[model samples]
Each structure stands twice: as C-alpha cells, then as structure tokens.
Target: MLTTLIYRSHICEHFPPHDLKEMVNAANLKNGQADVTGILLFNGVHFFQLLEGPEESVFNIYQRICEDSRHYNVVEVFCDFAPHRRFGKAGMELFDLREYEREEVLQSVLNRGTSKYQLIYDDRALQFFRTFVEATEKENYFEIPPADSWAFVSDDNSVQSASLPAEITTECSFAFQPIVDPLAQKTVSLEALIRTSSGEGSAAFFSGLEGDEVYKADLKSKKTAFALAGAINVGARTLSINLLPMTLVRIPEAVNFLLEEIEVNGLVPEQIIVEFTENEVISRLEEFTSAVRQLKAAGIRVAIDHFGGGFAGLSLLAQFQPERIKINRELIRDVHKSGPRQAIVRAIIQCCASLEIMVSAVGVEKPEEWMWLESAGVSHFQGHLFAAPAFEGIPAVCWPEMLSAM
Candidate 1:
C-alpha cells in the first residue's frame, strides 16, 4: 500500500533561486531512484511537502529530509496509508512559486480534499500559501510582511513555540461534552472539544497555521482546555484533553504545563485524562512511549481515542496497556443491526475486560446503539443520545428520563 506524509517546516535561511533549484534537482534524481513522489512548496519562510510511495520508501526519504539540517522545527502535519498516490512519483516537482501563477497555485491548495488537509491545515491555510506564492513571484521572499497572527515567534520554551498574542481570548474556546457511565448513573468525564467563538466548524476555526503556528495552536488548546475545565467546575469529574501524538512528541514538556494548570485549577493530576487518536501515525514510538510514561508517573491517565481505527490492532493494546480504550464510532454506529460490528465490539469489550482495561463506547447516537453496547459491556458512553456538544459551558444532558434521577 502507498503511504503518504505531509510535513511543514521552517526554512532556516534564504537560498537563492538557482541554489533552491539545484537542491530540487538532486532530490528529484534521488527520490525517482527510490520510486518516491511528492510536491515541495516553499515560501522562503515556511514549507509544505507531501511525500507518497511504498511505505518504507516514504519513511526512509522523510527521515533523510528530517536529518538534512537545511530546515528546523519540522512537524508532520498529515500522514496516512493512501489507497493510491495523489501526485504519483513526481520525484521532486518543485512548486517554485516564482514560476506558478499566484492565484492559480492558491486555488489548487484551496481545492484539495478536506479528508487530506482539513484535519491538518486550517481554512485560512490557503491564504498563507497564496501569500508565499505571491512573494516568490515578486522576488520579495525575504520580506514577508507581518500581520496579526496567533503564531509562535520563538522556541525558547520546551514546547519550542510561543504565540504572538499571548492572550488571544477571541479566536477559539473550549466546549464540554459529557462522557457518561450509564450503569453508575453519573458522568464519567467531560471531554473538552474545540469551538470557534465565531461559531465556525473546526476546519474554519483551525485555518491558516503553518510551521511553529502548529505548535503554538496545540499548546494554546491544551492550556485553554484545563482553564475552561476549571471555570466549569470539573471538580471531581474526570477531565479529558485531546492531544496529537505528533505534538506530544514535539512538545513533551506540554505535560508539565498541564500538570501546572491542574494545580492552579485546584484539580489533581489523577483527574486528568490525556486522550490521543489511535489511528494517527507515529514514526517514533520510543518518543511517544517516553511521554506516556511521564504522564503516568505524574498521575495523569491515558485513553486511546478511536480505538478500532488505524494500523494499530491488538498488537498496540498488548504493547501499551493504556488505562482505557474508546470503541471507535464505526463499531458503535448502528451496532444493534450490524452483526459484524456487534461481534467486533463484543470481542473488544471482552478483550479489554480480560486485560482489566475500561472500555468507553464513543458516538452512540441512539438508544438501540447504547443498548447494544451496554449489553456488550460498555458502561461508559459519549454521543448525541446523552447530549450534543455544549459549545459554551456545560449544558444539561438529555439523558434517558428514567436514569436522570438515578
């Protein structure tokens, strides 16, 4: 299968057009030899590159690029096992902004699929791409005019990033969604979900970030979740924070910041749950495992989000026995009618039970689905049936009337 990786990095210094082209030419010859393909877009400041090929070839090339020292603060924004290559075997087709029309290149970026870009780059991301292309065409690369942006200007701290406006109170906010333990007749935790104060979806809310902007945004989100959880009086309830595995590897000290926030909020580290996507690719599990150990040592727990998706299967569970595993929505949706889905959920529940790991079913939209999961041994649940995400403070749960009193 073809695996694709999209990475964004900061260019350490300016390279002349001829030097850049030479670099691209050499890369083209090298990648072509290995059947690797992708586009590299640079604005003399930030860069976005997409690489796709046989899994090993892509991984090998990415490692070589990472160690090359031409750039620093490299971050993997997107990666997946693609059904097929998108820009197959380009070797290294440099999207030299100088040669391409500014508007045309920007439009191509805007028109890219959400499934590929939305989760990584934000809506305004195209605008940055356009601006870079414009700068290249005008031969004004070194002088990218600064604007009011919530991007980190430096890497002085452990997160290696800091935002321009240290106090950005307007762009986004945290919304709490309840995760309930139906059998216990209580809320197991409140997962902090992101909501744009302007009331836009995630894609628009997260738009226009590149390079250190990515790290700055993630750090901001972590701090915001804890602060909001405090304001809403999470108190004794478990508070869950969504983190990207990639970000954790980049900013492992983020856990210390989280620890500080918990104390500042009069909360204990034990009440905190560090949730991460199970499907997200990690090139270095050694780094991730170290971070997880740090969290565990600090008394914070971990949960594998979207448990049934990605390359990880039972092997991952056997390797890392996280305190909890969330049943992916694909297995919970309409599980009452789908025999295969039911079987998968049962096996997961039974397997987790044997391992003494708690299982929480996510995206349970109907009572039948809940009923099925509950019968299969999922005591904790999250989804619309309990309550839709409250975009502001904690709204009341629309729990079953019979259990609301209990």
Candidate 2:
C-alpha cells in the first residue's frame, strides 16, 4: 500500500503548466527508477494518486513530494493493495473536474477556504468518500483495483521455504468426539462432547440449536432451561456450551437456569467447560475475560476452543488464564511437516504447563497424530479414532467395556 499527500490549494485550472510539468516529471522519474506503478487522478483543485511498489521507494517519493512548495494542504485520501497496477503506464494524467463528480461536495468544502481538509477530519465526509467509492465500483463506473497477484505467491513461497506444508482439507467426522482418559483407559466421567449439526441445517449453514425447549426427562426437566434440552436428555452430565461473544455480554437469565440444573444433576463445576471460539473470544477480550473470570469464581471451568487458529492471540490467552486450551486441528494435522507450527504448539503447551493450565488437542484422528501430541506433552485428546460423542447417558459400563466395543 502506498499513499502520497498532495497539497489541494496548489491545484488550479490556471496553474502554471510548467510547474505541473515539473511535478509530473518528478513523479514519473521516481516511479520509473523504483519500478513503482500507480494511477494519478487530479481534479482542478486537488490531487489523489495511488502508488504501489517496494515500501522504501514509495516512502522516499512521498518525502520528496512533501518538501515541494508548489503544493500545500497535502492529504492522503486513498491507500491500499491492488491486484495489478491500475496506472501501469508512465506519466501523470490530468482528468477533467467533472470526472470526479462524486467528490463535488468535498470539493465544495475544500473551496470554502478551510485550513484543514474537512475530508480528513469530518466523519460524514469520510463516510461519503467510502460510500461513493463503493458505489462507483458497484456501478462499474470505475474498475475496482485487483490485489497484487504476487502477494499470495510471495506468502506461499515464504511458507514453503519455512518448510511448512500447505494446508490440506481433511474429511472431518463427529463419530469420535468423546474425551477419554488414557491412563485409566476409561471414558472420563462427566465427559463433555462437542457437537455440530450437518447437511442443510448444519452449523455451517443454520448454526447450532438454540431457543427454549422443555426438558421432560432430565433430573430437573420441569425447570425453564436455556440449553438445548435434547443433548441433556441423552445423559450428558457436563454440557459444553458454545457461546458467541455477544451472547456472553448480555448473559441471559436462562443461563442461571442451566447452572441450577447442573447443580441439581450432581455435576461438578469442573465438568462444565464453556468452549469459546477463538475469533469470538479474542475480539472482545476485556468483556469475555471479565465474564470468564466471573464464571471461574463461581467454580465453572472456561476453556478456549479452537486455540492457536483464527483470531487466536497468545497475549489474550495468558491474560485470561483459561482453565484449558483446545488446540485447533489445523496445527495438529501436519505438525511433522511444519516445524514452526509444531514449535508454536510446543511453546503454548510449555506456557500453559508453567501456569498449571491443562491443554487438549482437538481433531486427533490418526494414531501417529496422537503419539506426536503425547510426545509433545499434550494431556487430553479428542477426535474420531477414540470414541464418537455418545447420545447415550454415562454408561454403567467401564473403560474396558467401551474399548472392547470400539
């Protein structure tokens, strides 16, 4: 992204052609020498240019432009990446003032003799500019610039050179979502199963089940419950509730009902792990952390779900001090191929370990993956290859029975 500030006052219909020529020559020389290509749009009273090239070269040209006395009231209007050079050709092109009809109101404001560009300081003006540009692009009056194709290639090359394997999409299954204790070789009591719908009404489409449902068969079925009763009826002692950040902010009274039910059902506070998506949690760090801390004070365990992926922030995780961290499947899928990712996971585990916090690896389907995670000092594993999330209640049967059945 490159931005050049141009003095709006210097622009005039009767401005010296020689001065304009000098400015154009300087801009062209800089662009040519640095291999920077961009577009220039000049109205009778203002100039806006989009430049793209090596960061240093662009900055150097901008500095030179700032020192020129022919221009004043310089301001940067637009700046960002483009797919290809919109102004690939050499030389500056002056457009008729009518060409920028959309900016007429801004021009009027600037013509009023305002010392500062109102477009920069006025919120309404800023919004108008954004809207106008968007509308222009949508109407096809102006082509929306394409992002630099080299951007993705450079990113891919960097990842490749670091020996990180390309991301591979794997067929995920909900069959084995149970959390099993390896040492006891037993399905852990009060196991919390993470569930997601599939097909047309899948979470990817319709999202998880929500709303008030009467629980006719639970320990406290008559109570007005907030959770999806269907999961509870199936005998899940500890329910992992997936919450959006907004929902956490205005915690509904129904949540209190759910907590009441947990207590009535003889479930431990530690049994209930409120799983928060990475993006949702970190975005509203202060609010989410405050809510989590409040819940923790009440004896409920808070686990950050899908950690180290999406909008995951290590700093936020440390500050929040969640009870457990669930590692995303992406990092675990090919830890062997990506040393940096593996190192990241190891670092996270070490940090969590030092804080006495537990770590679980999600989407661990292969034996090799499990072995690698175990070697990495990960404590808990969940995915298919172990046992699917059961609709059945806590089995009267023990680990041996479950293993034999598997």
Candidate 3:
C-alpha cells in the first residue's frame, strides 16, 4: 500500500547549516534507490519532512531519520495512506521556508506538488504544510532534553514487613509499586498489582480463567490487595487497585463487597482508588456507572487505567470524570524522542487539567521518559525506573537528582 508519513524536528547545534545541502543530496540518492519521494521543509528552527512510498520503504526510511544525529525533538505530525503521491516528482526535494515570505510559502509548497488536483484536494496534507510554514504549532512543540540528563538513585530502604491474615489468603497475591512524586520525594500512592500466588504476573493468573470466572477472580483479588495494603499500614496514603469494568457489572453487590472488605481490613474507603482499564468493553454502561457512583458515594475515588489504549476512554471521561488517568505504557515508551506521543500526552494532560483531574504516567522504565513526563506537567509516576512491583511488599522508590555534570 502507498503510505505517507509527516514529521517535524529541530536541527542539532552541532549540525552546521552548510551541511544541509550535503544531507539533502544524500537523502535524494537513498530515497531514489527505494522508489520513495517526499519534500523537506526547514523553517530556520525546525525541519518538517514528508515521506511517501511503499509501506515498508516509508517506515524503514522514517526509522533512519529518527536515528539521525543531525536533528532532535522529532515529532511525527501526520501519517496515513494516500491513493496517489502528492510529491511524486522527486526522490527528495528541499523547500527552505526561510527563503520565502509568509504568504508566499504556502504557494511555494503547492507549486512543488506532483499533482495540482491532489494538492488542492488533499486538505489534510496541505494544512500540515501550511501550519508548518505559518509557525502555528510552535507553542505545542515541547523540546525535552535527553533522558540521561539526570541520574536516578534508588534508596536502599528495606521493605516494611507485615503478616497477612490467614483468612485473607487467596488463589492470587498482590504486588505493590509506589506512584511517587520524585522531586517532592513523596509516595503519592501504592498500587496493589495482582499476581498469581506463585509470583507470576496478572496475565498468567487470568490466562486460566474463562467467562464469568475471569470477572469473579478480578473482583476477588482486590480483597487480598486491601488486606495487603492494610497490613503494610498504608495509613492515610491512597491505595490503587485495578478492576476490569465488566467485573463491576457481572458481580452483584460488587461495590458493597468492596466497602465491607475495606472496613474489615481497617482501611477507609476514602483512601481507596479503583482503576478501570479502558481497553475493556462495558457491555452494560448503566450498571457500571451505577457501581462507580456507589464507589464515589462511599468516598472511594475512580481512575481510568490505560487511558489511550482504546477508543472508549474519552467517552468514559465525558460520562464520568475520574480522579486521575494513567497514560498507557505504549505512549510513554521512549516518549522523550517521540513527537506524536508527546503531542498526545500533552493533550491528555491539558484536558485532565481543565477538568480538575490528576494524571499519572505508568510503566515508565527510562529516566528520559520520566523526565519528559515530569516536564509535561505529570507529577505522579509508577514504573520500574522508580520501583518495580514487589510481591506482597512495598519496593524502595528511586529518587531523581541532578547529575554532577549538570
């Protein structure tokens, strides 16, 4: 299939301006060999490029561009299939926006198009070029430093020991990982991640279950999570637990059962947060919302987990705003180097901020990922970089400090 990928990046300081001509010449030869054609636009500060060709070739060339040391802060702006190429005339052409007047830049871009009809008709592609030339999206382009800019040091504190009551033992166990504000040096909350009694992850525990058994196991696991949290004396700090949305609908008196368990375990409902993964299909919305209402009524808070993994997250937010939302790991992985991910995360943060909702970045394992997220207005974080999940105990959190070089 014919595909088009658009991206923008800032030139590195070490990349001399005179070398741009040689770079364009090199790109022309390489792209020509792969039957690819596109245009590169430089607006003095940023380089916006479009690549179009066979799906594999386009992606392969784009990957090379990302690894190129000549530029940084690369953000993918648009990507999709096109019936025909817009810049089919060249292997790779250069359009220096610095040379044209603001009003003339748009016309210059249109004139380079392979098809006048395609250029006039393809509003999305044209608008992208126009936006770059007009310097309209500069405000949203956050240029974060490299991830290794700071050092993450783990505090070698011992995990607090707590005995689990015999009655609370179950087929599964709980692993605790803290969501911490590294700069503030405070643990915001500890998420009780479910695991098999054998110390396997949640997927292994759920793999054996089918149908309603899955929901039953999901709801039942939280009881153990609560017991574990209480044993550790979480005190006034909040405790987060994951729940499949359908579990609330499938299990009757689910909210009441949770309240009873919390009370019996010596934890207040106010300190509990039930995180619902967005990927699950809520076949019965009314019933699930009703259960969420009961949770809120009892002082328990609600949060959406895996916020961008599915289409339903925004709809869920519109229906009922949660106390916080965890941005999925897919978006957080190498986010400091990904422009598209950065844009999406920024949008999510802005939307949550407007609604008075908190946001957290989960599954972060890289210092760069955490640093970019922290700069993007996210304070609460859960990931291996801070602390890995410790089965039945709390793990020591890694705190961030400036490197001596800084």
Best by the TM-score measure: 3
> In model 3, what is the error at residue 63, expressed in angstroms?
2.1
Candidate 1 per-residue C-alpha lDDT over 1-406 given as tens digits, one digit per residue, 9 for 90 to 100: 7887776666656545457778899999988988888778876566778788889988899898877667754555456786655556468677655555655766564344333552334433333344444554232111211112112121121111122223326877767778987656577888888767665656766689776666567667766667767666777989888876767678757778878877876789999898888876234667788888888999999999999876787677876888998888887876654435655777788899999999998898876677656656678999877766765566566544332222
Q: What tens digits encode model 3's per-residue C-alpha lDDT throughout 37-71? A: 99999877799999999999999999999989989
TM-score-better candidate, 2 vs 3: 3
* TM-score: model 2 vs. ground truth: 0.46
**Clashing pairs in model 3, backbone N/Cα/C closer than 3 A:** 75-339, 147-368
Look at candidate 2 and tell me the lDDT of residue 335: 55
Off by over 4 Å in 1: 1-168, 281-283, 401-406
State the lDDT at 2 in candidate 3: 97
The whole-model lDDT of each prediction reads 0.69, 0.49, 0.85
Off by over 4 Å in 3: 117-121, 158-162, 168-170, 207-217, 250-253, 279-281, 336-340
Superposed on all Cα atoms, model 2 deviates from the true structure by an RMSD in Å of: 19.9
How well is each residue in 8-95 modelled by candidate 2, as lDDT tens digits?
2234334564476566767777678887655444545445455556667776776666555555434333444433443455434433
Residue 239 displacement in candidate 1 (angstroms): 0.4
